[model samples]
Target: MRVTVNGESLELSESTTLLDYLIRRNLNPAVLVVEYNGKILHRDHWSQIQIGDGDTLEILSFVGGG
Candidate 1:
């Protein structure tokens, strides 16, 4: 299946969850915010939310300052 992440094309296995994809891509959830198809997904819900083909995902990571 194909999905778009941050405007970049991504291919994933069928029935892959958002969290699974993130892990597969080596993304750190502790520092990143995940949005699925325009809705912001809570950290606790990432594992349950399934990603579909043609879905749009946006990932944002927070930065710390001294």
Candidate 2:
């Protein structure tokens, strides 16, 4: 299956969840906000939300600096 991560195209196995995909791409979920198909996914819900074909994902990581 093919999916896009942060605007990059990637091929992954079927039934891949958002949380699994983030791990595979070395993305840290703790500090990042994940949006799937225009809807924001709660950190706790990533494990339950599966990424299907043609889904557009936007991952934004928070930076704390003052």
lDDT of each prediction vs. the true structure?
0.90, 0.86
If scored against the real structure, what TM-score would every candidate get? 0.86, 0.81
Candidate with top lDDT is: 1
* Tens digit per residue, CA lDDT, model 1, 1-66: 899989999777687888988898898889999889999989999999988889999999999999
Q: What is the C-alpha RMSD of each candidate to the true structure, in Å?
A: 1.3, 1.5
Candidate 2 worst ten-residue window by lDDT: 10-19
Return the top candidate by TM-score: 1
Would you list the clashing residue pairs of candidate 2? none
On residues 1-66, what C-alpha lDDT tens digit does candidate 2 reach at each position?
787878999777787888988898798889999889989978899999988988889999999999
Q: Model 2 compared with the native: what TM-score?
A: 0.81
